[model samples]
Target: MHTSDEIYHRVLWDPRFDPERFVMGIAERGAPPKRVALEDFVPGGEIPWHRVVFFEADGHVVWDRASGVDRVGEVVDGLVGPEPGDVLAVPAGHRTAVAWLPPDPLWAPIQHIRRAHDRQIRRWPPHVNVLFGFVPEGEFPRALPLVSAALAETPPFTARLAGVHWFAHREGTTVWLDPAAAGLEPWARLRESLELRFPLCGGRSHGFTPHLSLGRSPDPHPLVREAEALLAPMTARVTELVLLARRGDEPMRVRHRVHLGTGDVHHAAEPPPPGNPGPPPAV
Candidate 1:
């Protein structure tokens, strides 16, 4: 996710411009992915067209847009999203844009996001997504056992999931729900347990903001208001925890799924088993 500082280099929500239009700015001369320079760009009326690309630590994986597109990457079929610090091709146009979009609900997006989450639930194994901070590949083992123990010690509970809403972030507007409102106690329990065990996962300066992300909205202001009106809060029962491995060429694989209430646990997939040249596996 682009922080406010970084996103400001691209788009903005201005009252002076038309709500339907996103204001795209000119990137510095000769930036990779081409700097956008939309003609007749208006503050709120019509902004520049923009698209973005995400980069993994090692090299380019999949463009957040799609595959049928070239220059961004192999023209794949589906569209993914950009992670923190990933490059973006900030552009928008009058054409029927089909890729890298927001929740396209005409009314309530809460239902849309909930449906998406439910679809994901049905496909991948269910997991209690507790915050452990992000451990680099090198520190995976150092965090695995601690996180595992924390999961073992924790019990299952229901988390309230309000309908999806927009967050006016520096990185455009992100659509997320506040699960902590209902899952606060359990969340704290897990955080404290994990923190006491490891250095914890977050930076020292920033606290934690546990959220279930739906997606980032290109245009946030109207959607935020519409979401506030149409989105309905719901609940998700916390029972199991799963470690998901994302691959560029395949469906996200489930490394493991552990039932929270029961002591029973099983490893669905083995590590880079024998000859893997990497740190220990982790969620």
Candidate 2:
């Protein structure tokens, strides 16, 4: 499946398909498409984990599930999906998409528990973004203004969120369904038009993996595993976007929120530091 033009994705199910087989061209300014073929030192069981880590590819439209992933827990936490992934190809685009507010039943507990697990979770930040494309570096500071204009000019789009599932990744890195797959398309189309002008301007490139993120590795596995049944399906019209600022492993600081259809920017009462402090060291 192609998430965007020039970007391709394939789910590698065959155990024997070594990553070293194909040559790919990556995205680089004025650089010729490098004839790069890679090798894999992975076994099938670890592919789920490996797929989210050990790869550092970008600028190429080839969405190799077997391509560029880095092994750091924080990087992998953001890169991997909520579900255990057999998927490859980190998405290349902007994360400036719409937002979904899950029902209280699902949202409340996840936030509480994930907060307690804050010191341990690598990338479950309780937030999601509909990335459009990677933007040129110099143009990023205008993110808020651009989003504001689009929201005011564009009408609110429809989207649905209706599933709850538990997926385990790596050493107990578990996540629940924010199910961006269920709701992002309509918003994705909307974000696409503006994205042509702006790519990953809002945040890091997380590929196509989209989920609300319940918690992470050091969380209680059996508890999270069983609580899967407690979740109920939810669908709501996404009407806004929450701009976030984080400080390592402390907590997510809400910077601003932009209402859809109005493009109104709701700045935080106390804004966070200018930028994120990034992921903390693994405990």
Candidate 3:
């Protein structure tokens, strides 16, 4: 049996298949009849045209102009109940078409966050970006304090936002840190230590493993190398990730940290009751 998700996709692909109205089409930069494949039938006498298909769903065109060449224009128009400028291509079976639009802008907020951080860095003192290790489920409460204390004592710079993160140990790799169980914190000590010992160790947070970072510095290779050497001998359990944020914007600083604690415990502004609420009063 088709799962609901699969059925939804099918509907999105061809809503008309189920007699339910949907839209699909290809959007192009320039005018319609966007040239696609070319064929020479009689020494280029009006050149044979290739078929195109346009897919439409939810009243919007999702395919690009190149994709429109697949569906015979007439079929797409008919599927959408006809409209002007709906040119049809020969050999309808040869082409497929779909509605196309610009990519979604859901990531706008992230862009804003980046901009805000960039602006703040200009006024703040020097700092370094460091990736802390992950805290397994049910370990955040115990770990967060250790991380917090480290930052508090960390000389020169202070720890800022500690939030969950997703990162890869190597460059060009991607991983996700469960937001429900991740946290970030900014540490000043780490930053100053690196600067004093290895000035060149700045701005090299590109491909650090275990995938959590504090902030960017100039070149971090030497500092990271030294820190690893030192940490190897001791028990280095990362309880938090940190960054430097504006003092007035402390909440924003905390917003980015990943809480690796269990059951969304990191989100609670206040402590919960001794026991769970069994049920609601009768309505």
TM-score winner: 2
Number of backbone-clashing residue pairs for each candidate, in the order shown: 19, 27, 76
- TM per candidate comes to 0.44, 0.46, 0.20
What is the Cα-based lDDT of residue 142 in candidate 3?
Answer: 38
Compared with the true structure, model 3 gives a TM-score of 0.20
lDDT of 3 by residue, 1-283 (tens): 2221222233332323332443332234465643221121122244221222233333434233353332212344345431222111111110111101101131222222323223332232211234221222233343344334333443222222223333334443221111112222223333332222221223224332222222232444433433333222211233333332223322112212322222121333321112322121122
Query: Residue-wise lDDT of candidate 2 within 113-146, one digit each (tens)?
Result: 5564444334334455555333322333445666
lDDT of 3: 0.27
lDDT, candidate 1, equals 0.41
lDDT of 1 by residue, 1-283 (tens): 3322223322222112121222222433467453232223433343332433332212333222333212212222332222223222122121111100111222134434444333342222222245423443234333355456656777887777564555676767666666656747777666555443333233424565666655456676555565556556656666655544544433334455555545244555533224322222233
lDDT of candidate 1 at residue 247, scale 0 to 100: 41
Q: Which candidate is the best by lDDT?
A: 2
Q: How many pairs of residues collide in model 2?
A: 27
Worst 10 residues of 1 by lDDT: 94-103
